[model samples]
Structure formats: structure tokens, C-alpha cells
Target: MKIKCSKILQYGALEIVAIYFSLLMVMSLLTGNLVYRRSQSLLAAAIIVVLTSHLYSDRRKYFITWGALGTLLASVLYIYYNLNDSSQVYLAIKYLSFSLNESCLIILTVSMLWQRTKKFILVLLLILALIIPIVFWGYYLSMDAWFASDTLLAVMQTNLGESKEYLSDYFTVSGMAAIIFIVIVAGIVWRNMQSVLLVKEKKHFTAFISLALLVSATACYKTRDNLILNTGWKAKENLQKYADFQKMQAQRKSIVRLNLQENGKQQGVFVLVIGESQSKDHMSAYGYDKKTTPWLGEAFKQDNFIKFTNAYSCHTHTIPVLTYALTAKNQYNELQLENAVSLLEVAEAAGYETAWLSNQIKYSAWDTPITVIASEANQQDWINHNIGETTVSNAYDLKLLDSLKSLKLTDKMLIVIHLMGNHGSYRERYPRDFAVFSDMSSEVGSYDNSILYNDYVVSKIYEYVRSLPEFNCMIYFADHADAVEEKLGHDASKFVWPMTHIPMYIGFSERFRQKDAAMVNILRNSQDKVFTNDLIFNIMLGLMNIKIPDIYEQENDITSTYYNSDIQRFKTLYGQRFVREDLQ
Candidate 1:
């Protein structure tokens, strides 16, 4: 019944190899990485064969029996904990599962190699353990780099330079400390094992040594692929193709010039407000239960404000939507803006002083095409004047008004105001006073509060415009609608109509009303079901009283009755595409 030291070493080696193999399989399964799974399986099988051979030769029952039992229990616990979905600790357990599985492999490897040529194998495993963590950290760094810059910087508190500095500092200190600790522990274990091992025990240690080599090899391979993908060399090539497509399409379209028939006939001002992340379902003006849009509702009841019932954003995200909306295109697939121009550029060409005021952060604007147009037109101005405790509060729509007041409003000018409306986490977007409904405790309630704050901000802007004598006309619509209900813990991936549905409003001054009553009624009664974003170029042409180009004449005009039916059929066929191309 007595155990030989050599037999004990063999049994321990087999147990360790089995535990390591199990952990590798579990890690691969949990991470859902096919590459890792295939590589680990190859290495795990090699380790298992070497260890099992030694186990069969060993006579001692105690070491092999107890070690096998312990391995089984650990593997079972790992699988069970991960499978339970209802538990609150599920996410925490999932995050730590990979690390825990790796630790189990480490423990098994070290224990099995404790008796034969123990000094050498112990030292190797220790150094290898340190390398394993460094490799994992490198993978994390690579994945972070793969994501877009806007996404990465959005979560960080510091500016770009400071954020990079922080990440670099964290990696250097943590990596060095972990490597040093592993080396010191290995040295101690190796020295102690040297004093205790017999010469006869040396052959049995080969099994454990092979297991250490297998793990090190797999980690290095995975880390190498991770680094390559993160460099984004391929993504840049794809972007170039998209840009080329846009440029080529623009060149194909013909340009038509407009001339003023009579100078100083009747000067007018127009303010176009572009809102972000607003849903029509949350607005009281759209018949929602919450009084989020009380002021807008009252304003609509008066004959001044005209509301469009079925406006929708072309895309879900800002970059794609704005690119298409401003360029007179739908998505990046088709380029229609060859000789075409943005409404702002058109207005400027018509001898109007144009200005673009925005509450969005300066960097976000700089990253997009809208800012490029703003810069080219020399009408750039940001309204992020407040720098308070909360970053979100500093850039609300009200700050845009502050910037607007400083500008000189001429009789013939066009002002574009871009508002940051109802972007989430909804609670952070609004003030505490906007929390009107007492029963609203969930994410939906927070969204309601955000909508209320946006309504208040819109009312404030409308009041400012109404008080100004030079400002005669104002047009307001959301840049895109949001997934308000889905954002409140529901499925957000399912694209719904309400997610894209937006509200459009137009207000005319007394002077404009009296002078252009016939034209005003034409716009008001127009039953056009045209895509809202695509109407930008044509509407601008109509407002300026310019002759329509060959391209424009071919497309549906919002001012005509025939235009309405054609747009509906177009919408039914190509959806947004017909509007983007035919209309442009």
C-alpha cells in the first residue's frame, strides 16, 4: 500500500495533464473563439498522451485517485456556474471564468512537476506562466485598437493624448510586476525541488515539461493573430473604395445655375434646426401620453407651426445619415451629389450669410463631413460654452441659443442649428426637474425625462426666433429617430418604424405669410410622401425660386401634386434609394 516517490510523480503528472486539457476546452467554448479551440485541442491531446503513459506505470493509488476526483469537481463547477442564466452573478462569473480556468491549469502543471527534475521544469513553468498573462494583456490591447476612435474615446475621461498615456502606463507597470513575481516564485520552488528529488525521478518529469511547452505555444499563436487584425490595414482600403464611389457619382450629375430676377424684392431669414436621437413616439405633439412636448403642441394648434406627420431618418447612426442627408444621397452605396450641393452651400451662393451652430462636441463635428462643409462655407461655430461637473450637461441644446444670440442676424441669412437631443443613457441627458412622471422608475422612465428636456429646449429656441424681427421662417426636424422602447432593456436590433420616425415643423413670420400666401399654402397642403432627407436639395431650389436643373426636373418636386404620388411609388419600390437618387 506504500507509495514510491517515482510512482507518486507519475500519477500527479497524469492528473495535472487532464485538468489542463479540460480548462483549455472550457476557455475555448466560453470565449467562442474557433481558432483558439482548434489550437488548444491539438496541444491538449499531446499533453494528455504523455501524462497518461506515466500514470499507467505508477502503482500508487492515493495520488492518482484523489487528483482525478478534484479535477472532475472543478470542471463540473465551472460548467454549472456558467450555464445558470437567472443568477445575478452570471456576468461576473462569465468575466472571471477564463482566468479561473487558466489558474487551474497552472496549479495542476506545477503540482505534477514537483518530484522529477523538479528544479528545471518548475523554473520553466514559472517563466511560462508569467508570459501567458502578458500575452492575454496584449490581446486586450489589440482588440481595443481595432474598434473605431470615436468608440474608444467616448468611454475614456481624458483627451486623446491623455487616454493613450493612461493605457500605456497601466500596461507597463502591471506587466513588469506580474513577470517579476512569477520569476521569484519559480526560483524559490526550483531551489526547494532540487534538494528533494532523486536521480531516478528525472524520466517521469518529461510529461509535465511537455504540458508547459504546449500551453506556451498556443498562447503565442493566438496573440500573433490578434496583433495583425488590430492594425486596421484592411479597413482603410475599404474606406478608400467608398470615397471613390462618392466622388465618381458626383461628377456624373449636371449643375444648373440660378439668377436673381429682382434685387431686394423681399428679404427673408430661415433657421433650420437639426436634432439628434429624438423619437416621435416620445413627443406629446405626436399624441404621446407624457407632456414632453407641451409647448410644441400648443404652437402647432396656432396657424403658425406646420407639422409633418411621417418624417423618418434615412439611417440609424449619425455618420451615415448626415453623409447621405447633406450630400443629397441615400447611404454610401450610390453617389448622387456630383454637381449637386448642400442646402447651406446653395443658400450661401444665393447671397445669404450662412451660419452653423452646434452643441455636439468639437471633435465629433470635426470627424464628420458636415464640419468639412461648415469649414468650407466659413460658417463654423460651436455652442459648448458650459464646462460644469457633468460633461453631458455642458453641451445641451440651450448652449446653442447662447452662441446664436452673439451672431448678427441679417434680413437675408440662413442659420443652421444642430441640437443634441435625447441621446442616452437617458438619465444623464436631462435635469432632475424634467422627471415629471412619479411612476417612471425604469429605463423607459429615464427616456421620458430626456424627451421632456428636449421639448423644453425646442420651445426655448422657438421663442428666441419668434421674438427676432429679421428671422421670418424656421424649419425643425430630427437628424434621426431613436430606439427608445428597445433601449429600455428590450431587443434593439429589430429595426422598427418608430425607431426611424421623426417630427418635422415649419414656422413662418407675419411678413412671409402676407407676401407669399399662395406659395405658403402650396408647401403646407403638399401631400408629398417623399423621403424627408432627400427633399433637402429640391426644397432649397423651390425656396430660392431658382430654375430646376435637368436632374431636378426629372425627379419629384414637393410643391407639385404629381410629386406626391410619384414619391409614394418610389418609396414603395426602392424605399430610401429612389428619394436619394431620383430626387437628387
Candidate 2:
């Protein structure tokens, strides 16, 4: 058997076409993008045309081998750069590893189509063995709980503008199935080749065997480097980007020092309850049909709870929202300046024993300066409770009550309680016993129950605050709202601005209420439809009745507006400014 030019051309075209098809199939499985499928087909057609041209001219191993190696290497490097630069290296490796592992099986199939024997079976098994390590690598990169289907879907939809459902349904399942299909196809090709080929054609099979082994080796080595490069580049980029962002942020940070003119004013205790993932729309207090927030509704009607009718959170996520809300710049652009003085720091400076108790895991991390300010007390005395122990559960807001009880409050105390209220999966956030509604079949019932549980927790906190003789004022608001459930056709994780709109209620003790009646009424009627999270700093200033410096008083001062406005100007000016700066 002599190596004919036509035969070489045919095999080379087949190899290129097979590789292209495998790439497209894997990409389609990973991204579920129709455009990618079309692109893959076009590229494969081009490769076929080019190979046919080469065969028409003369048989050349150099063109085929070099082209295959170059294209594969370029693709691998592109995937690496995108993943590394975007702080999504894990996902990059995951998708690439799966693609290559699947491609190896495809290579085996193509190889066996040319020549099959014990050698082909051995090579197939070798590739199959490789799949285990690749799969394990994918799993290792996805160690975080947020990488779960629900969480990742939400995150992808928010960041990428594509629903996780696309990735989950088509990409993930189909990719795995395609990999298995390739394995099966390889076995079939091997059996078919063995039946067709005899001992006389053995010499002709050498080129095909060498091509398969070389392709597999190249892919394996490239995939390994892809993982290493992605992870290494990600770490370097994060540090550099954070440092650059911090430098930019520092240029704009002009911390205002309060000038205290009055010396004899009596110091009082205040509590700010920061609720997590609670939507005002679900609360009866906000006129929802369900009586989920009965206690809060009663409190609001009685004028005990001075409700801010239109208040929105700065950001959707806990870390971003908490950071922005507490910092002087309650916007995303100023996120790098998170270490700047917060309301807690201001309160602490004013001779208040500031204590922070949180049910959030991330809040316990010392990386955040706001967390440090909140949990300034001794670690032994600080309450870092994890109430949500179940797989899909969130901590009950009532858990904060026990933590609060442990704290020794002073006359001038600023207690910041970060509650795990209504943090989803909705059903797990609440107890089964709280499923009072008859219509328990639907997701709405679960949400209503979760809202009710949150309400009950709020009531308990209120009762505790009311019992405290030294506690003069209290402010409560959720960090952000929840999205509709998964079954509702809406992405349950994408936070709408309306979803970020939360209820802000402030209450004062009888004595403090009488003394600050004018200020209270001004706050009640303040028409400024300012963002609630931004009010943290100004509210602290107002409560302490201290004069803030001119530099901090420039941008949309809620206090200056008497907290009254239906302008919704916060979105237009403040929102656009941050977006513009972020892009720059």
C-alpha cells in the first residue's frame, strides 16, 4: 500500500472537518448560542475547501499538521485571555476542559474511522481515562456554593444579559451528552475499521495513528496550560485592577468632619436594622393583599413607625449594597473607597459604643472595612451567628434577637444588626409551620410564608427595641428586594431597580419623639424621593444634629430636601454618573 496524494488529501480534509465539527458541538453545548454553531460550520467548510485545494496541488503533511496545531493553540489562548481578564477564569477552564475532553473522544472516533485494531481501543481507553481528571478539574473550579445552577444562572443573567437557563438546559446537559456520544461513536468506528481493514493495509494506517496521537497530546498539553495561565493571570489582574481602582477612588474621597457646636445635648441609643433580600411589595405594610407584614402595618398606621414611602437600595448584592450604603459615596463607582468613614465610624466618634451583629457569612470576613466598623467589639463578644444551616435556607431574622440580648448596651449605643430576612430559596428561608395560607401549591405561597416569617422577626426586633429604656431611636430597611421565583418565566436572580426598592421605617421613643416632633414631621413629609441607602450618612448627621462639612453636602443631600421629593432624580444623575465613571 503506497501513500497516495488523493488518499492523504481525503484523510486530512476529514480530520479538519471532524475537529471543526467537534469544536462547534462543544461550544454549542457550553454556550447554547446558535451563532457559535453557524460560525463553526462556516469555519469547517473553509477548512474543507482549503484541504481540497491542497490535495489538488500536491499531498503535504506540513500544511495540515501546522494548520491544525496553530488553530487549536490560538483558540485555547483566546479562551484563556477572556476568562483570565474577566475574573471568570474558573468558567473559562470549565468550558474549555469539557470541550477538549469531548474533542479527544471525537479524535478517537476519527482515528478509528481510518484504522481500527487493539491499538485504537487502547487509545480510546487512554482518552477516556483523561476525561476523569478533566471532569474533576471542572468540579474543583466550581467549589463555591454560588456556582450552583440557581445562583450561577442569576449571576450570568445579571452580568452577561443571558439567562442561566440557556447555559443550564442546552449547554451543560448537551455538552455532557455529546461527550458521551463521541465515546460511543469512537467505539463503533473502531469496530467498523477492524471489520473492513486486513493485514495488507496495516502500513497505510501508520499516518492516521500518528495524527490521532499527536492531536490528542497537543490538546492535552494546551488544556493543562490553559488552566494554569487562566488561574495565574486572574490573580495578577485582580490585584492590579483593585489597586488601580483604589487609587482612582482616593482622588475623589473628601471626608467631611462634623463640627459639634452644642456640648450639653443628651446622648441617646439608636439601632439600625439592615434587612437582607426583603421586598416591600410582599409586605402588607406596603399594601400587599397578603397579611404577611401585619405587625409592621399596624406599627406604620399607628405612626409609631415613620415609613419612607419611596426608598431604594444602592446596589442589589449584599457586599456592594452594604459597602455603598455605608460609605460617603453611596454609588458603585466609589466602591473602592469602602474603607472611608461609615455611619458607624461617625457614631463611634460621637461617643457611641458601636456594635455589629450579623447572620451573613461574608459580613464576618475582615476584608470589608464596613464589617470591621460593625464588629468593632472583641471577637468573643461579637455575635457572628449562622442561622441558615439547611442547604437552601436563610437565617431567621429573629436569630438576631438572641444575639442582641448578648450585647451590653450603653446609653449612647449604635447597634447595627444585619438580618438574613427573606434570603432565598424562598421556601427554605421560612419554617414549614409558617405555611398558614391554604394555597400552598404555588410558589407565591412559599414567598408569602417567607415574607410572614420575616415580618414576625421584625416584630420581635421591634418588641426588643421597645423594651430598651435607653434606646431612643431605631431605623430599619432592607438591603434589597428579591426577584420573582424561577417558574415565573423571569430570571429569579436579576435584581430590578423596583426589586431594590425597600421599606425604610424609623421609630423613636416617647420622650425622644416629643422632643424631636418637628424633625420627625419634617422627615415624614420630606418629599425627596432619594435613595434610602444613601441616607445612612445624612441620617446619622441629622440624628446627632451635627453640622456636616460643605464638601459632603453637595450631592443630592436628602437632609437638605427635608427627605421630601418625588423627583426620582437619584436614578438620572447619581446612577448615570457612576455608570459613566465605571466605563471610563
Candidate 3:
């Protein structure tokens, strides 16, 4: 009796050890000295697994094995399908692996509790694991129509519209056939899983459950990856952060009353273009060796255009940089930008019809930071997909031309066009005919070609507005620039000069600068001044001849006579301080 009790204790200890190591593998940062929270929970679950199997006199662990395998396969397929575009393939793989690791943790934990859960409950769990990929089909399907990568910001709160945004694109005969094939394969895998986990003996069932838990946990921790994997169970974190961030943008009031003035004809159009992953260093207009931007180059030569030589993005990533670019926020007053009226709000208040047109994901804006600014635009519509990042797309920027044509000419109108300009997997950005740069390797050549294509798109937009009446101006700047060579691409941990030095120029119609010659000179004189994009909110206001209250700083505005150019005050997003020469 004494010997049996000791052996039983040893058996329990081994089960606990397996779960403990597994927890450590996924969560290396998880620290616990005196107590083991994970160990206790796991031990309890293991005991439940044992007792439940014994009570049922069942040798079958159908739920555990089948569910885990199904989930594992589902997760892998989901990732393969939805991976976003990355200039650095390694970064793409790294994030994919991280997300998969979290799925494994879920699988293991779920497997251990399968039999303990009711049959109906288990079925629900199985369906959930199976459906995650389908939930993304909407975005992926539309992507094939024209597509690319996007992040959590792109996945607004279980939005069915977003989930099925590409349904029509994927439901074609061939697409339906592919879906049928997947369903068949899934059925087979689940059936096989049942057979594989079936046990004829009760002892075999208990031992298998215990050993499987222990072995899987230990092996996971023993691998080269140092930290334990995070569960990341909370799926809507980005949506929540977006909500919290927006309240700050709408709620804060710095002035007793808002005031705005239209410096030009209140009857003209102002187009502000927000470009993605474009760098000034690569643009011909900015004097790169390659003529990557012939259209912009010609525009630069025109006296109506004022190109800035030292403009920087506030952050290297899209969300952070654009949050400030579209609103009145900077690196210093992050807290204040919250509740600050965005450019669209100001434009609307001034009785302008605001329109936002993007070749990016639409559903992402519903709950992300982009929504606040986009909400200001009466015509803001999504034109892209939240599909996997690296998928090739033949969709061209010119597709937006039709939409722009529809807006027609309007008085006191503000149009914002967001382009998927020169983002990675660059070959997909342009049609094969646009591939003009030949001497360089395909990677670099593809990038330059995308820029060239961008030049065409920008010129088309300029020509359209050029035909419009009154004092109209067209402004183009990148959300943030990319270092095409960096392994993590532009969102690297450290600063690289090229990543923040994006192309920015105000292309005024012949009529716009003529409205006030002194205004043009003020815009031209501030050309060489060191500017950060976070000041875009203020810049947008100033360009429209809108006078902000005395509260907001004027130094960030290019059109302000008081625009600041103290070399000492300039700083990049990565905290590197620079002067005029440093920018060069």
C-alpha cells in the first residue's frame, strides 16, 4: 500500500512537470518564484482528464486529438492565407511563426480539456477552430480581384462586412471548387484524427493523455525559441486601442470656440494624397540617380510646385505616423492630439465636402484610428483588401481614376486619396509593362518601377484637378518611408535616415499660387525647412488659408510666415536629432 501511494505521487509529479515546462516555453517572461499558477491549473485539468476517462469507462480521447490536429492544421492554413506583404521575408516568417506558436498553445490547452467539456461544447470549439480561416475569406477573395497585406487595424471587430468583403470575388466557379476541395480535406482530416486517438483500453487512454501533455509541453520549451508563447486570446485588442485613442481625438478641447478661414477661393478643391512606403531618396523629383518619378519631376520643375527638401515622418509605421498626419498631433503633444479636431473635421466645419478614397482596406477603418479621420470624409470608401501581405496583385493605382472622375468638380471640396504606393512585393504594384528599370536586379527594379507607376498615377490626379476651376492645390506625401533593404523593412527597431525622409511637395494649380503671390512665396520659402509629418494637421489647415486658434503651434506649418526652422529643434521618429546637412 505504501509503495503504491508513492508511485501514484510520482506519476502526478511527472504530469505537472510536463505542463510546467510547456508553459515556460511559450512564456519565458512569465515569472513565478513561490507559487506556480500555470502548474496548478494544468494539474487540475490533467486530473479532470483522468477522472472523466475513468468515469466513462472510455478509452477514447476523441475530442483531445481530433480537435488539436484540426486546430493545428486550421491555424497553419489561416496564416499561409493571410500573411501580409513584407519587404523583408524574414520578418514575415518571424511574425507568422509567432502567431502559430500562440495557436499551438491553444491547441494543447484545448486538447487537455476536450473530454471534460460537454459534447455540444466540444462541437462548438471545433467549429470555431475550423471557421477562423473562412472568416478571412471575404478579404482574401477581394484581394484576388486586386490585393495585398494589412494588419490587425485591417480587421475591425468581427465585422461581417469586412469578413465577407471579397465573397463575390471568391465565389466564382473555380473559387467554389477550391472551397469544396478544402471542405472535403477537412472532413477527411477530422475523421482520421478520430481513428488515430481511439483507444481500446482504459489504461492506454489515461497514459496517452498524460504522456501527450507532458511530451508536447517539454518539447515546446526545449526548442531554440527562448520565450514562452503568449496566448493572445484577446482578439480585439487593436479595436479597443483604436477606440481609446479616438476618444482622445474627439473629446479634448483646447479652445473655447473653434475658428477657421479659407485663404483661397472657398469654391475650389484641395486634394491631399496619403502615400504608403514611399521614400524621397528613391524619387527622381528629389534628385535620386534614377528617374523614378518623371511625372513628379516635371511637376517639381514647374514654379507652381513647392518641394520640401527636409521633411520627416513622425513614426516609421503607418498607424502612428498617420494618426498625427491626419490630426493635430506631434511627437511632443501625443496626449493633446487626442480630442484635437482632425483635418476632415475642420474641413467639414468650413462647409467643404470631404471625400476619402483609399486603395487600402475599408473594414479596418471601422474601429481603428483611421476611422476618426476617415469619418470626417463623406465619401471615404475602402478600395483594397485585408488579405495576406505577399500575395501578388495586378490591381493598378489607375483603378482609382474612375472614382476620382465621379467626384467631378465641386466648390469647397477636400479629397484625400490614399495610395498603396511602392509597398513591398513591389512587382505586384505595377503591370509588367511598367517595369522600365533594367540594369538592377529584379527586387530593386520592381521598386523603381512601382515609383514610376506612382508618378503616372500622381500626374493623372494632378492633371484632373488642374482642369478644375479656382484656387486648387494638390498635396502628396508618404505615410512613412521604407528602407527596402532592412530585414524588418521600415519598421525596424532603430532609425535609418532614408525611412523617415519621405517625398513631400505641394503641387498648386496655376490658379492656386496666383491667388496670393506672397502665400506662394511663404510656401516656397519654407521649402528647405526641416519638417515632421505630424504637423500635417496644421499644414493642411494653413494650406486652406485656415487660421488655427492661438493655442496650436505655428512652427510646424509650412504656409505660416512664422514657420520654425531652428536646426536644433528637428528630430526624427527614432529620436535622432539632425540638421540640414544631416538630412542630406
Model 3, residue 120: distance off in Å is 14
Per-residue lDDT for 101 in model 2? 39
TM-score result, candidate 3: 0.61
Task: Estimate the lDDT of model 2.
Answer: 0.53
Q: Per-residue lDDT tens digits of candidate 3, residues 1-584?
A: 99998886787567546644553333222121222333333344344333333323222443354334434432332333234222332222233333333233334445456566665665465466545344334223423321112233333332443234223212355545545655665556455443433232556766755665564445334331311111122224434556766776544322313555444545678899988889887888888899888878777788988999888887776776787787666665544544556777777766778898877645444455676678767885555664433223335777787778887456788999988787665766888788899888766777789989999988898888778775488888898887765423354233466778788889887776777678789888888888888888888877776665753567777777888778777666524445344645
Q: Which of candidates 2 and 3 is the stronger one according to lDDT? A: 3
Candidate 2 to truth, TM? 0.60
Q: Largest TM-score belongs to which candidate?
A: 3
Cα lDDT listed for each candidate: 0.53, 0.53, 0.60
Q: Candidate 2 lDDT, tens digit per residue, 347-397?
A: 554566777777654422343444444544322233333322222323455
- Best-first order by TM-score: 3, 2, 1
Which regions of candidate 3 fall more than 4 Å away from where they truly are?
1-239, 245-267, 334-338, 380-395, 493-495, 572-584
After superposing candidate 2, which stretches have Cα over 4 Å from the reference? 1-266, 332-335, 362-364, 367-370, 377-395, 485-498, 527-534, 546-551, 554-557, 562-568, 572-584
Question: 481-550 in candidate 1: lDDT tens per residue?
Answer: 7666654211112244555667877888877776767767876785235445545555555555544344
**CA deviation > 4 Å runs, candidate 1:** 1-266, 331-340, 364-366, 385-395, 488-494, 527-530, 546-557, 560-584
